[model samples]
Target: LVIDEIKGRDLRETLIAFGEHLMGAYMSPALIGVYRTVVAEANRYPTLGRTFYENGPARATGRLAEVLEAAEARGEIDADDCFRAASHFVGMIRDNLHLQVVLGLRPPPDADEARIAVLSAVDVFLNGVASHR
Candidate 1:
């Protein structure tokens, strides 16, 4: 879903779309409840965590890695490890905001807030990985 939204876009645009998708997913109450349940039961059911990771985060990361690989081929970025880069990008998008939301310390970001967060992350990430020449 997210990969389809981000595919064929330029690096900045791709990151923006990706970030927005992540923010939407993270903000979903149903998903939050499911994640909380999964976390709370993870110790008792070890396979739950692995299952969640494989089905959710792992799939997202794999798709993002494909996007990053395409960006590298296009000379938009210079990533030696697309999968690691994809993970880093996801981490950056989540940041402290996601932690705060997950902990119930704050409400989910509004659209403007999400945009600002995503753009900031995209800029920083682009600066780090953009092709030197």
Candidate 2:
């Protein structure tokens, strides 16, 4: 479902969809708890961190990087480093909402809120990634 959401009409639409799905997925308490536990035990259990990265954020970032690289190849984006751009794209959309949810500052946003948040992040990210001729 998440991966399907990422395939959109264009790069910007794809990013917006990706951000929306990501926000939806991360809103889960179980996922948030897993993140907290993984971070807390990372030092004592290195493999835990490695496992989390391999199964979670790294996978997402890698997938997005592939898309970004394709866009770059097509001359749609001027990305010097697609992997780094992927990371920034996900981080920009996810970090603040995830933090707010984890800290109990706010509940996971509803559908309308998610739309607004994802679109806003996509706008900012698109601006940053725009080719400066």
Candidate 3:
């Protein structure tokens, strides 16, 4: 059995670090690779299947919130639109990504079928967020 271990990191510290990177002050290719690897792994593993979707832990909440907040602050989108975009993003993550993790499907490469299934979810999320303007 492959057991996933959690490290004991302070949530606030982690959030701050994420904010720093996401705020565009510093971009981390490593972080992007990590997330890509996650998707790839989820595309693997048969048991993992399509359960990766709806996996709340896998959803990057810090990035999501920061993006919404930044957009609002810039007046790029109204509050209602910002919230709508966030909701759309969250919903897609829940229904597609989290759902895949729940199905026991490890990331892609191991489960290509699962990855294919969720692409539409990603598209929808992007479209929704962009529409928030």
Candidate 4:
């Protein structure tokens, strides 16, 4: 389901889908709690960090990087640094909405808000990449 959410008919659609999915997942209470607790205890229990990386963001970011690399090969974007671009892409999605929720500065976005936010993030990222390329 998670992988499918990040797969689309095209790169643009995939970015949108991924952004939407990421926002929704990150905003979930269970996920947020896990992230908080993991970070807080990761130093004392180093394997917790390893587990989180393997099971969580690593999977998504690695997938995203692979997609970006394919897109670059296809001349779809100017991604000289596919991994960095992928990381930045996810950061763009998470920075505002996810951070707000984590900080308790704002509630999680509703479906409509999530849709709009994801759309905007995809557009901004695509535009930036287009120009950079």
Candidate 5:
């Protein structure tokens, strides 16, 4: 669903959409609970961690990498490694806000906060990767 929305969009648009999806997922209490549970039980069932990584973060990173590869091909960005770039972008999107939420240090960001965070991340990421030409 999210991947379909990001596909064919320009780099900035794709990143914004992906960031929105990350914010939505991170803000969900149910999803957070599941993540906590997964972490807590992962040591006992190592496959649980691998399964979560493959199904969640790995899938998201792969989809983002495809979009990034397209952007590089079109000269919208200058990434020699789309997968690595995608991982960095995803990290920026997650940021410390996700950590705060996961640790119960703070509630999930409000919509306005999330928007600001996403936009900021997009700007910084583009500054680093945007095509000079």
Candidate 6:
């Protein structure tokens, strides 16, 4: 009976979990969509779109910096906070780039992390725009 119980418990190791399927479904389009959204939104900003087109990653970082600067000038948030926010946003993007390749693990270890990162980036963008406006 005891051996049977252990085998039953160990059965989980033999079976593939369901979340692997979900992340596989979501991650690809997500990476592409996020890239497009970031580019599209940055373009909406004055001179930012061209800057991004000429130099992608450098421009993305620059856009975040510009947003941070505007936020600082408005006194709505601290500079370090903006920097941290942008760092997370960048990390999330970087992680998403990696996670798409490892979708077999249940729940995809970085899926939640990536979602939060994307949200953080969007939040910073919105807050920055409001500050500048």
For each candidate in turn, give its C-alpha RMSD to the true structure in angstroms.
Answer: 2.8, 2.8, 13.2, 2.8, 2.7, 18.2
**Candidate 6 lDDT:** 0.46
Q: What is the TM-score of each candidate against the true structure?
A: 0.90, 0.87, 0.33, 0.86, 0.91, 0.34
List model 6 lDDT by residue over 39-99, tens digit each.
5687468466665455644544455555555656766556666656555544444455444
Candidate 3 differs from the real structure by a C-alpha RMSD in angstroms, to one decimal, of 13.2
1-133 per-residue lDDT for model 3 (tens digits): 0011111223323323333322221113343344445667875763343453344322445345555666567664455665455555545434544434434463322234434434545555434446565
| Cα deviation of 85, candidate 6, in Å | 5.3
- Please identify model 5 stretches exceeding 4 Å from their true place: 129-133
Give per-residue lDDT, candidate 1, residue 8.
70
Identify the runs in model 4 with alpha carbons over 4 angstroms from their true place.
2-8, 129-133
Q: Evaluated with TM-score, which candidate comes out highest?
A: 5
**So what's the TM-score on candidate 1?**
0.90
Q: For residue 77, what is the lDDT in candidate 5?
A: 88
List the pairs of residues colliding in candidate 1: none
Error of 6 at 38 (Å): 20
TM match of model 3 to true structure: 0.33
Question: After superposing candidate 3, which stretches have Cα over 4 Å from the reference?
Answer: 1-59, 81-84, 105-119, 126-133
Q: Mind giving the per-residue lDDT tens digits that candidate 5 earns over 1-133? A: 4677667777888799888887788779998898999999999999999999899888889988988888888889889899998888889888999889999999999999999999999998889656779
Task: For model 1, give the 10-residue run with minimal summed lDDT.
Answer: 1-10
Give the Cα-based TM-score of candidate 5 against the true structure: 0.91
For candidate 4, lDDT tens digit of each residue in 27-55? 99999889888988999999999999888
- Which segments of model 6 are wrong by more than 4 Å? 1-54, 80-85, 102-117, 120-133
Give the range where candidate 6 is weakest over 10 consecutive residues by summed lDDT: 10-19
**Top lDDT: which candidate number?**
5
lDDT (10s digit) by residue, model 1, range 1-133? 6577667778788888887888788777777788888999999999999999899888888888999999898888888999999999888887898778878999888989988998998888888656779
lDDT, each prediction = 0.85, 0.84, 0.42, 0.83, 0.87, 0.46
Clashes of 3: 40
Q: What C-alpha root-mean-square deviation, in Å, does candidate 2 show against the real structure?
A: 2.8
What stretches of model 1 exceed 4 Å from their correct place?
Answer: 129-133
